[model samples]
Target chain A: MPVPNRPDRLFRHARSEAIFIASFWLACTVYCCAYCYMYGYITPSRPLTERDVKPIWGVPSWVFWGVFVPWLVCGIVNVVFSAWFVADDDLGEERAAPIADPGGTEADVA
Target chain B: MRDIWRDVLSTGGTRAESAVIFAAEVGSEPKALVALVVFTIASLGLGVAANRFVGREAGFLKKYFLGNRSLGAFAVALTAAVMSGGTFLGFPAFVYAYGWITALWIGSYMVAPLTVLGVMGKRIGRMARRTGAITLPDLFRERFGSPTLGLITSVLVMFFLTCNLIPQFKAGGVIMKKVLPAAATDWATSPPSDDLDIKVDLDTGYMIGLTIFTATVTAYTAYGGFLAAVWTDVFQSVVMAIGVLILLPLSLWSAGGLAAATARGVHDAGIGYAFGPGAGRSFHPITLAVSFFFMWAITSMGQPSTLVRLMAFRDTRTLRYSMIYLTIYNFIIYVPLILIFIAARSVVPGLSKPDEAMPSLVIKLANPYVAGLIMAAPYGAVMSTVSGFLLIIASGLTRDVYQRFLRPHASEKEIALMGHVATVGVGLVVALVALRPPEFLQLIIIFSSAGMAAAFLVPALMGVYWRRATAAGAIAASLAGSGVVIALYALGMLPIEGTIAARLLPANPDIGPASSFRPYYLLGFDPCVWGLASSLVAGIAVSLFTKPPDEARLSLVFDDGPAVEPKFDPPKREVESRGSEEPEAPAEPSATERRNE
Candidate 1:
């Protein structure tokens, strides 16, 4: 029987998955740049308190929109990625190696 | 016994004199001291237990060095995630200094778990098993079929990790000193110079802390090896997590709230602390933010100690679990740190040194028991980091240097003896080097961590993924990256001055403003970025020029999933294991050094 080319599938999945996470990072970076450079009310150069008071989700506009919001998005993205990410594509081999670990031999804490 | 112990660690001044000076400097806080001592004793106890546990294992080298590759998900996550000094002390210190720009520095950390666990973890683990490799250099050597590569990589790792150890040692000393009650000299104000006989005593405090901390960690690590390190790391990580988790809410409450903290900052520092890079803002030229994000991610991914944790985990299941929990742990540690330290500025308004900000703020804000626990937090960080490095250095010495070069035919008993010796010896040398600490904790860390990542990043990744990654190419990349960093430190604008090497190198030529030409910082890039670029260029260019690594050679290690090889199997005839009876042909009988059963 011919061995299936599963590495190809695994590679594609891995690459796309990486891109999925990186897109979030790059998106945040772009948003930060726009928040600082494009916005009218806030500037990185001057003191931030000068801005007219605006709050989002119980945080000031300058912070809520710029920093903490992106972090919240990252947390959610990671949760989804962890719970449902594609991992360990089947190579269709009947007896693939069991990925053995020398687990209990040295330091098994009860 | 007390006098003997004091004399052994003495630095000219008497303990009584030092105590008096300490008294004058600050008030006493015994609760913090008691907390630190409890944590310290616990660390030493874990080390002792782990050493005994490892002694009975099948192979001394494999079991002691890699914990027999038996780590659970929780152990792996905690040990790897607790990047002691950097996360606990240096990170908070850096943020306290630069305000909201800390977010900019650590932004890429959002994707770090994804990048590290997803991108590198499985591949490195699979590779380690394929070659029966227990260390980073072993992987490089086996994959590339080059002893020269192994030797060079080992030397670079040891040298740079020693450089990395300095900041940790300094931070450990600083935290210890911070908690000690002020040295009440009882001398009058403006006493005469001879009559005063006074010293700043930070160095004295640092020396004492360094000796005790180093002694405890080094002893345990030398005894138990990687098992001891990981066991203690699990515990240390808990202490840090608990300490921080408890302190943040309490600190916010103590200082009123975020709004109140900002109000205080505006009143005193004349700028918004919570939302902006105030008057003393360090976020200039914008590129720094991007650079720091790259640094933490790259440095973390490439650190030898961190990579070892990846290889040592039980399986892919463990890797997945670690990824999830470490992400959550990082969120708990890092986000709260930014909030607490920003709030801390309200309490510690005139902190002259940025690094001292964490300890000072905790002392002021936290209740006695909580303050003590939090005070031990940074020490926990430093010890965990130090333990990891100590083990790696031992592995490098025993596996790469001693067995491969000096005694390829050495017995198991001999290698084990040497392994313990080298672990202790390396720890001692690092402690000595750390005695005279640098001015900025994070800057030196950047130079070392960044340089290390630049050197190993391409070689490590390409060697894993790229089938055509030649030994020559990997060599070129490692050389190009590390070589650039060293040259820059010697000739370019290094932070520390008054060196003999500085006198020898050509005086830095009068250059125009930073915009026109940044010689010291070439194109506004750190040595790390410069090194990374050079390595990429060199690795690619050299591989194209050189002969490709053999197809059979590539077939052994170049796989997407777990390698389909048994842990103790012999190399198939066509592929050829490098265990022949010569240096050039580099092979030997697998005696007691097989991976643990």
Candidate 2:
């Protein structure tokens, strides 16, 4: 009794969503790895505050690679996701439901 | 963590070295003061002018609360200027004091635009439009048909957001103290030494700044509402950017380039501030770093003031443009800031108080007029944030409480007047509390905002995308999440000196056993992780067992099936398919209408 929609034909919504989430988190994991290996693994496991690390360019090495650059990449990826991937199904004309009745009984008010 | 840093930052530094060489105060202050006065007046003038354009007939509450749901990308972008003030000031201060690991705490801000708008804006904007929900709690009430849930949300957001506002007031005071040190009261005359046992006099500049900030924000927002607030934000954003652009190159130039500055300034090299083992040697513990990383990356979406912008955009394209523009803006403002603060370590070395790093650097490097321009930027940031929150509190008071509970049949005239009255009242309360701030400005900010995010994150997202999410689930999730956060905050506030737990934290004699902020990483984890966990579990568990929302309402919010969220964790209910694909039994008429009738 369910109504078929155009989006379902392109791919399973669940499957597409699953792949996207997996890939995004995977990239995040990759970024974390980049931070650890390149920046030095003195994080959760090592817990060492190596006071002798110098900057690559103007920024510290781990910060440039681990924090700043990775953040840039993540931001760009999120921007792309925002533009192309987001759908307006709930917001579109099909679902432009009217506001709840203003004069509704008191129970609905508070 | 809160009490440790709070006491240390506010009282003095671990090693508050006197300034090696204090720069003579710049003489161009009069010119800069003129510019600041003019700019402030112009902003107020603009606020009053915008009021004429708002048609009062469309229900002033609606027009005021949501700009009549007609915000463009530019308005949305300016509304984000709050990131400029306290963060801009506090971030650099932290960097100057702690060194490299501070990068991780603020570095997470780069993703803020992406999470705030790109992810949450378009969807929530559309949802708010469709459902006629203005405030965040209204979305919950209508979407889930739970007024009780709505009321609880209002109380929770109001509590934490008020806590969040304290920092902005303090930030305003910080800026004032830096620019007009003369304005500071008698107590600030002989500045206190970097001793934990001694209490410093309240800065005269701060008192003046807070008064000015509170008065201006309350005035414009009270008169013009959301649009005025957004418009002022736009102006503030421009001022902030100009200040940073001017200050960035100069600060870098003063520091003798990044390489020299880093080498000369960081005596211990590598900053010793990584998030793993041996961090006692550095500025960070790995546990804290990881917590901060996740916190900033995700929490921006949960802020009610920021999220409300989603409810007002003109259309989907506006949301898109706002995202794109915000990303670019963040880069423009934040990148240089990172460089500027690092350079500050050299330009103005050995300050007893690091929070004065930026303001002090500007006075030393730039002319008085330029300093004023730069000083105004953070003030802009704080004003935008404070005004936005003031409006939110006002809207909450008038619509959620008065209109909903006390005056269900109140006339429009009463509603409009109440809106203005509530804004002033809220502003006054916040300013009064700020007169005697409890801890470091940044510490209070982190506590309040993080708590808000934890409390609302699960419930807001679930209400939007999940079909099976029930009112009971939402109520349970919100209560549980906030409960954990408050409990953790309370525990952190406890005086735990002489206890075995004290071994976990760094030693500071000033706080004695009264600081319960130790034990931040019990079992090697943070409370935020636990708060989030409890929220999700409670929401998912209660909703699955309880009756789902009406099939109609569910279909409306997550139409055409294939919800974006559940794709991560595939829904167990096959009955919840979208667009009638293998539909389950037709749902009973939900309380949406029956309860109304």
Top DockQ hit: 2
Model 1 per-residue lDDT tens digits across residues B477-562:
99998788767754564443688865665654332112111235555555676778788888888988987774444544654332
lDDT of 2 by residue, B1-597 (tens): 323443334211211111100111222255555655666686688678768776655656668888877788777865653455544455666666656556555565666655566555655765675455778887877777777888999998888778777655655544444445453444455454222111223545456666886787789888878888788788878777777888888988889987666665555334342222212243344554555445655665677877788787877667667766777777777778778877887788776656677778877888877776766555565666777888998888987898777876677678878999999999998878776766444444555666777778888777765667888899988888767776665556676688765676654322111233432444334557667778889999999999756554555555543221111112355544443432232122222333336
C-alpha local distance difference test of each model: 0.61, 0.61
Clashing residue pair totals per candidate (backbone < 3 A): 16, 27
TM-score of each: 0.78, 0.79
Task: Let me know the TM-score candidate 1 reaches against the reference structure.
Answer: 0.78
For residue B435, give model 1's deviation from the true position in Å.
5.1
Mark the 10 consecutive residues where model 2 chain B has the least summed lDDT: B14-23
List iRMS (one decimal) for every candidate.
8.8, 8.2
Q: Tell me the chain A TM-score of model 1.
A: 0.54
